[model samples]
Target chain A: MSVQPQTQARTRRTWLRVFLIIPFIVLLYPPFYNSNDPTFIGMPFLYWFPLLWILLTAILTGALYFLGA
Target chain B: MFTFNPVAFTVFIIFFLIVTGMGFIAARWRRGDLDQINEWGLAGRRFGTTVTWFLLGGDLYTAYTFIAVPAAMFGLGVLNGWFAVPYTILVYPIIFILMPKFWSVCKQRGYVTAADFVKDRFGSRTLAFAIALTGIIATLPYIALQMFGIQVSLAALGIPLSVSIGGLQIELPLLIAFLILAAYTYTSGLRAPAMIAMVKDIMIFIVLIALLIVLPAKLGGFGAIFAAVAKKHAASPTTFFEFLSPKQNWAFVSLALGSALALFLYPHSLTGVLSSNSKNVVKRNTALLPIYSLMLGLLALTGYMAIAAGIKPPKSLGANYAMPLLINAQFPPWFAGFAFAAISIGALVPAAVMSIAAANLFTRNIYKEYISPNASERAESTVAKWASFVLKFGAVLFIIYIPTAQVINFQLLGGIWILQTLPAVFLGLYTNWFNRWALLIGWFVAEVLGTILFSAAGLKSVYAISIFGVSFPAMYTAFSMIILNLILAIVLTPIFNVIGLGRGRDITVATDYDAEEVLPVEAGREALG
Candidate 1:
């Protein structure tokens, strides 16, 4: 099941590269989004921002995977 | 409130029996020769994307996450609790990068455990032994926590705890539950959990979606839930809703980052990763497993719902009972039974995986390394199978004898110890410049200092310390210890090399870890690296 070298190089170019960076940005700086105001569906910003990123991160990961990275 | 409801118990038993039947049938499902260590321990390295997803999801998100994440919120708000959301989130990216390398390398070598890979990579048996011992010891308390999860469900169901038998009091239900787990795990090995996880995860998803949708409407919505929680915090100023205080900022960040780093270092997490058929299966699963993380976040919100609904645990079971009690209070009896069944079976899937992973460590790293170098593959399989039985039964006994709070504290302490391996196993994957003995010394220093700090803080599960009498507000001990560990390894490596000490030979090359897929079964079987 070894990938052809040409195919492997193309996989290396895929957006899967960004999979790790998005998390480091969202999770490392909690103070930026840590508040109970500006509520979404009656949930706090502090709570919902992290929850929202859960979906966004998943989408990012899936996009990268499909892009062949 | 605590009366025995036969309806809940009957539904619980019904689901329990179905899981048991699944367990027995799993041995022959995708049938393999059980005599080899590969078939017995790694599920023949044949889990594709779907099976790997369910297995990893089912294994990583266990009963403890179901019961305790919410309980952490119900009892103490942000610092102790909400870190779980980010902890779960950060784990995937970390696993995405690190675990595929692990899978490729382990596959190339026929290495069954992380310790087996470590043993070959650095050409150091002692270092591999350290890693294996750490894996076993670190996992035991976690397995014990799963048993505690079962105990919580039974307590809610009002199962008789101490039924006198043969002139001795025993936790009869807990004993019976573990015996069933041990039997199937012994007979079927990793396959039992792989099969049962599919059922456990679906049941949990159904329960969570139903409960989350209905509970918020029943309690008048998320705003009211948080309002009730805020009211409770205002009533008791010192305990709840510490997010505004900013005192716990370090604690929150460190707890999340530290645990995310520690998650995949665990033997069982590696067990799940190594069981997959290829690197792509693992990489794809990393993308999809976050669905479970989303479920975990919603489930953690249910803790506040327990508060808003005015559900209180009986004094004996304490706050951990918050989730189970809330289920019984809000749901009808049969649904509560299915919920409890979900929790009970959730505990089993991971428990089976942990024991199998730990047993493989024993068989490969310890038993084969020293006990009998030429031990047949059959002997290795036999050793791992019995070791799984004894190891899990021991975990069951550990929880029964110890207090649940202490078991939790002990598990936190286990996290501190396991993170010490970062320099040895995790870093060694990228580079082996550090002397093996330096890594060992770093691990020892971190273990001792982490323990002393944990003990110094009045045995608090999480603590921050005063260095040179400058007190820091609370931070996680594991994160602190890992920093000290990394520094020690960095500092001591060149110092050891300057003296007469020597670095071990690196037998593995970089390309070995870039293998595209696992070799054919016969080819992989023939090479005994």
Candidate 2:
């Protein structure tokens, strides 16, 4: 059950870095990609803004499980 | 302010009084050595899954979300209002990773606040003090925002309006509300607030579900509602449908992401985590709390309904009153009263929890540490109780003095300030590589820079820039500050390490996260010592 301090610390760092970067990529790209026309399930990129959080949650949870576990 | 129905007002008062009575009794819910800080402030760290779920929901979904989210959507259109949905979704996973470790460490060391853990891990009172100070300071405006939520709800209920004489209003009813809340919170601590949260959550569900069902019928139908919204957007294209535009998309994403990171870092959220009895409780709550987020999405739809129903907010009132106005305009008088009570109760539970969290920080970090290092457990608990009272009173003052229109800005301003604490909190949770002094320095830089940018943008109510000739609000300001904070910490940590300013100390050997299922000997010793 005991995790080596070094390994745990490294895992924590990796998770932190991923958290910092993922939001940037997800938020920054979609606006640019769909600047001309945005559509997801007949919803505009604007309408999809809130729903994007679903993907963000999955990514964050997956990363946390990977690193923390 | 509308006229309050006599029968409805009577019922609401009776319900509120009953809850207040229960809160006082809650002081004894989880009986323990009443002398200790943990026993008083964290309910002896013994809440199981069901209680913890209700507790966290009550703590997180405040009157702000209840009134403000729908109000924002109703007033500004869908783009601005979507922030709540994402922010709630993001908070779950972040906490899932962080809370289990936090719980383990806190339980093992008998720590009452995050500052206690920082102090133990770093072996530096200064660092711990900084953490405590940041937590208390950042949480104050938040507490004030809750009071603001109450004031908005009360104003909508016609309580404050009826008291107005010539332009001089007597806010006696609102004052009375704060006094009642302060009394119960001082008596019962965490138990008082946790117990009340159950009532608050139930009321919220009832009111929201009723509004969702009833409002569409009032608005003619979903198609009519959307059509009205479309017309509104068509008239003002810049503010409404164009999501990728600066005011909408970037600000929405940035605010969502920034808030998600900062949400659990708040001392109140940490209080929720440390109060849990087991790690499984935290994990289970994490997966299930999304149900609240789903409710939040449904709640956001009320704004669209308001627009369709043609419910225009009064000139003096803020957008936060839109939902209340819509309810009064559309629902039966008794139902409107019930919905108003839901919002009022929503403000009460979170405000109570917030003050308790702030008070705990003051007692554990300030009073017990520098003020009297050898302070007894009883003395610490006493300080926490008094601090909670004073903090709630201060929030009452904030509600009284600040104009309602400015209250929303103050909430956002509070967010900007609190987000400054992320590097110190989220980073320090796992590593000692961040020098205490470096963390402090980073906090200072971020606070200064973020404030300047936010203010200089002229409270433009939006910060946008031209990217390839498209205008977008500069939503990334918080993210920018966090980045700057991290960079400052990273840069200064090594320099301080080289200079031996804040050398790493021995962290507790027992990994508290793993201690969740099993009762570690260290946890027992720490708790009973």
Q: Please tell me which predicted candidate would have the highest TM-score against the true structure.
A: 1
Q: Per-residue lDDT of B1-529 in model 1, one digit per residue for the tens?
A: 5668999999999999999999998999778988888999998988878888889998999776898889888988876778988998888877877888889899888889988888777778998999999999999999999899898888889898779989999999998999999999988988999999999999999999999889999999888988898898998889888364667677888899999999999898999999888887787887899999999999998888999999878777778989988998899999999999999999999999999999999999999999999999999999999999989988988998898877777878878888888887788778878888788888888888898988888676478677899997788899988988898888998998899677878899988787865345434333211
Per-residue accuracy of model 2 over B388-490 as CA lDDT, tens digit each:
8998888777767877666666666667767777765666667766777887788888878777777877643245545599864576566667877889988
Instruction: For all candidates, state DockQ relative to the true structure.
Output: 0.63, 0.20
Question: Model 2 residue B111 lDDT?
Answer: 84
TM-score of each: 0.95, 0.87
Interface RMSD, every prediction, one decimal place? 1.2, 4.6
lDDT of 2 at B288: 68
Worst 10 residues of 1 chain B by lDDT: B520-529
